[model samples]
Target: MSVRQTPLTCHGHTRPVVHLAFSGITDKGYYVMSACKDGKPMLRYGDTGDWIGTFEGHKGAVWGVALNYDGTRAATGAADFSAKIWDARSGHEEHAFQHNHIVKSVAFNPQGNLLVTGSNEKIIRIFDLQRPDAEPAKMMGHESNLRHCEFYTENIIVSCSDDKTIRLWDVTSAQEIRKLEFPNIVSDIEVSTQNRLLTLTHGNTVAFWNLDNLSLIKEFEVPTQIHSASLKPDKSIFVCGGEDFKLYKYDFDTGIELEAFKGHFGPVHCVRFSPDAELYASGSEDGTLRLWQTTVGKNYGLWKCVQAPSDLDKPGDAEG
Candidate 1:
């Protein structure tokens, strides 16, 4: 028997939701951010999807948004050819970094001191948050529009593009360290917290790679083209959504489909797991963000500390 668990819907954006990010868990709980074509990026409670506030300064459709480790700051890239940093607590703009073409992705280093922005110009730029007026460190190589990028280490980053490849680079040296080619255009990429495993979607396939040595670990073929996917921090489970308009969860080690459910009316564009590994959020073309618990009908956050009974408490006790 199963308990019918429903996702909490977050609404407000008038356009399609493109990207989503979750802040590391904190004393106040984790926060979620969403970027949409409506030109507004919003903050919400990670588990509940309750609206907190909106960061409202972008002049064009916002394509990507990320929250710093502690959720104190946020960075967003937009179709306006610029990226902006905001004080997450107050929803106030802090700095605006300009680009030559539409900005597609934005990410913050683990330390929260550096920001990386990828754009339609096929360039990746790293900006120092401490010195907003200074020139950003730039790197080049992607032949097509950028899709996503994330810091693999303090000095290294992995980025995917529509050119059907992924490249690893040294931010300090501004040189490519490794490149992995794919058969089709890569749509999205997600890395584990330890940066050891990465999962990506291209065409109708979802593949995993070893981030440490740059090797393909495994691949899973899905029925439809996936737009986004995320692996649980422990690498035990993964979830994906896309053209099928369904959310599919799988066991990473065995490649077994655990759950497949219909949710959004439109295709899902992005999905991310929370830091605590308890829940995940999905953004879709339906213009809303939905939150799902890792274990249906289970409240891990509240009952995680409760202890189970001893053997003596069982009906057939050993001592008896």
Candidate 2:
């Protein structure tokens, strides 16, 4: 037997992995970056699951991780009231950021020169990576815990929080430019490579927002609370997962649930799309990372791997 699905195991930490990201390809498609409650981040080759390097600097749990568009650098947010920039390949510290509260999320701007971070303190701060010691411009509008955010352009960034609102920030002014209120608290936000916005909130609803005007485009109701989402490099499609344990894909224009993947034994905590958008990776409270292939129709035999799927076939490996 071919064993059904391919699998790869990464087991260095004792705690659960909360977030994972693909560097868009600087490591020759071999490295996958991950963060955990243990207050550290690990980089390993996706093909062999060989631990390449480690990043250690946070006093509390590292809650979020993000890579620049170029894949040369990475950013991490921790409960220690700060977010830091690191050299993706060397694991060297680039900059340290101080925020109002425990940092919950961090994202690099679409241009890759600026960084945005959100926190329980209810504010988002914008930092210019070139100036490591300069004060960051603050964005204040969210009233509750701001969990995560994404940048739409060099000047605009959107953030969501428990306050039930999404606010847009202007990098130059480092202030709130606009706001959109949701029915419930937002747990995560993703901006598509094409500039469309998707946010997963307190309920099962995933609302698509238009960044140009900050208007609602569409929404699909899920069966459980959503935790995270990933936008394909194009604006046409995206995927999200939640405590409901269901993974969903939908059309950006119609809000139709096109297909789904269900097999994880625990709540899904995070989801991400690869640089090319052909593949995605997810981690959960259940202690596993699931990888899937997405297209217009159902995901067939392309791949479906947990903990690094070593079974079906490797990305560049030929079929047996």
Candidate 3:
């Protein structure tokens, strides 16, 4: 029998955590950024869940958060009708781009030169970070409010909405390239640039797609209604949580459930794998973030291994 590992629970949020993002591994290690309904966004050391600093200024609930590749910058979208960019190291707001309605999601392009945002106005906007004063390029199509958006590539962007469709757009042309309709509203999407796969969760289905061609790779029916799902960096397994207030892990290829444990007292809203795939983090309506090990009993970060008393030799038991 295997011993269940205790997850590291991170506290501080006063309300539900709506979104979470992990930065790429940096020289100082990676970082985790979180958005909460309390109108506060926070940054923490990714490995240890140590609170770093909170980005202040939003007057309404923060809905989305994103960290740049090198962990030097962060972006957030909020119900305050704005998306703001922050200097990750200083926790200072650099730019606040105002929107007509609530901004639901934000993403930084690979080069960190551009930012894209989705809003309740049913539009997607691309802002050039280099020229903060310039007007942003807009893309429109969805009849309902936007849920999430991200850059599929340097020249392409992908967005999902309450309209039950995911659309891909050419950034340069500002035109829709393709549309994927789902039977239910897509709640979450994970784009793995490293693995070239797109993971989407909707209704009771978790689907994987080929990022290059937008082809259907595989789809699995989950037992519970999941809001978010993230694939391991190596593509071996995935972890997800949702309405049932339980975290689940499953084999990626076999679609076999590996683990299902209840940790959060409330529903989980977001989950993502660490850059190293050492562990994954989940944000919940309980107003906390929990980190679980990919491989239990393995010593990584703050998770140290301990030997049982019977396994340890007596003081004088060993020969010199």
Tell me, by lDDT, which candidate is best: 3
- Rank by lDDT (best first): 3, 1, 2
Residue-level lDDT tens digits of model 2 in 1-320? 22233323355655667888776555376456777888887776553445777788889888888877556788999988889999978889888887757888888876788888888887787788888678778777777887788787778777778878777777788777887776777777776646655545557777776778877777777767888776676667778888867677777667677777675667888887766565577777765565666542223333333333343244332111
- Find the 10 residues in a row with the least total lDDT in model 3: 311-320
Q: Please give, for residues 1-320, the per-residue lDDT of candidate 3 as tens digits.
A: 23455677888899999899999999999999889999999899998888889998999999999999899999999999999999999989999999999999999999999999999999999999999989999999998999999887899888899999989999999999999999999999998888888899999888999988989999898888989999998889999889999999999999999999898999999999999999899999999988888887687887755344342321111010
Off by over 4 Å in 2: 1-9, 45-50, 234-237, 250-259, 295-320
Q: List the lowest-lDDT window of 10 residues for candidate 1.
A: 311-320
Tell me model 2's lDDT, rounded to 2 decimals: 0.71
Query: Which residue pairs collide, candidate 3?
Result: none
Best by TM-score: 3
Candidate 1: regions farther than 4 A off: 300-320
Candidate 2: pairs in clash: 6-309, 6-310, 6-311, 6-312, 7-309, 7-310, 7-311, 8-307, 8-308, 8-309
TM-score, per-candidate, Cα-based:
0.92, 0.82, 0.95
Q: Could you give candidate 1's per-residue lDDT for residues 200-284 as a string of tens digits?
A: 9999889999998888899999888999999998889999999988888999999999998787889989998888888888989
Model 3 segments beyond 4 Å from truth?
Answer: 306-320
In candidate 1, residue 128 scores what lDDT? 90
